[model samples]
Target: MNALPRREAPWAPTALRELRRPWKLATFALGLGWLLYGALNYGIADWDVGISLLMGGLTYLLASWSVGRLAQLRRPDAIGLAVALAALFAAWYCVDGVYVLYHGLAGNRMDREGNFRASLLLYFLAGMIWFYRGGLAELRRDLIRLIPRT
Candidate 1:
């Protein structure tokens, strides 16, 4: 008897799926909170908090997308270029996070150490890496299954 071909369930893109993660949802919520806080307390002058949060969220999404795209590229030179771009993106985020955290600490009168902001951003960075790896795995698996066997 002949075996039937396997059918897999339809799924969303890896980058979009990353947004559905619990931690990512939390980050979006936190971004909204920052937006609200900045608007109510100090207007556009203090908009950095909200903007940083939004950027952080976008970074996670884009990193996942990058990993997914990287997995599909066939050329060695293209892969190397993609890797370099990804690294540069990550480094930029790190520097931006530090700047945001520094400004946050400078603005806060009561919290001299800025421990809370630092820790929160740190957690988000770790979450971004986690999301990227998860997306890579999922996309690679799908790509592998798409390959035709002789």
Candidate 2:
């Protein structure tokens, strides 16, 4: 009689096991980069900028937590969580960018014009990249489950 292969149960990975998931690590790094860039370019005195920063920090925390939960039973919902957070951040940036552009058109300080646009672009790019990575990871996991073992 042939022996059947053991099935691996899905459970959140311990801190020691997290390193094995490269996608999670990459997501964390991307979040940190966004946080740092936003901090350096914008002063927190403005309420709009302050709120955006706060949300960015919170999003990073959630992404970190999700990394720990990666091994848990296929939570396709994690991707949705990450995407929602990213969309929120992007919307915030878009609103701020429009406000800044309006002021600039009115002949206000044009010094930070380029910086503002660059920051908005960077945030958008980061969000998209994270979303894409999460999607691909989910798809890969699904594919793995579909393959039959000999």
Candidate 3:
């Protein structure tokens, strides 16, 4: 029996291939932005910087995994998944904000160090999520190219 010709996915365009190379750079910039925000807002506390670095590393890992999964799945709806992830991130931020407000109402000091630390972490998470969205957008564009036009 003759072997079937290997199908090259039409959506895997060279432009998309080039885009993947910049993801790491984008991630790095995101990490740096988080660090700068923390330094500016919190005055470079040791623990805050350490936690921000740790969170940035975690964000990078999550973004890498999501990108890999998107590449493996040729479906044109990866953008939906990206949007869902973004929503989840925002929800978490809102919950955290409410918690902080509750603590403030409970008579916690307004200038508590912990609150500033938490804000640093939140800023880091926000920057990382923004970068992740950028990467997802590129992936979505590639997936869109895969759909066969009628």
lDDT (C-alpha, whole model) for all candidates: 0.48, 0.45, 0.45
What's the best-to-worst order under lDDT? 1, 3, 2
Residue-level lDDT of model 2, residues 1-150, one tens digit each, is 112112211123332243335774566566656656665675543324444454454343333333223323244476545644554554554535544554556555433455456545654444333332234467578668989999
- Per-prediction RMSD in angstroms? 11.5, 12.1, 12.2
Per-residue accuracy of model 3 over 47-119 as CA lDDT, tens digit each: 2444445445444433333333333444436665664465345344432444345445655434435545664
Q: For model 1, how does the per-residue alpha-carbon lDDT over 1-150 read when each residue is reduced to its tens digit? A: 111111111134544555676655665577557655764776444345644565555454454344343444455475456564664455445435544565576673233245336534554454444443333456568668989999
Candidate 2 — which residues are off by over 4 angstroms? 1-25, 30-90, 93-111, 133-150
Model 1 per-residue lDDT at 141: 80
Q: Which candidate number has the best TM-score?
A: 1
In terms of lDDT, which candidate is stronger, 2 or 3? 3
Model 1 clashing-pair count = 0
When 1 and 2 are scored with lDDT, the better candidate is 1
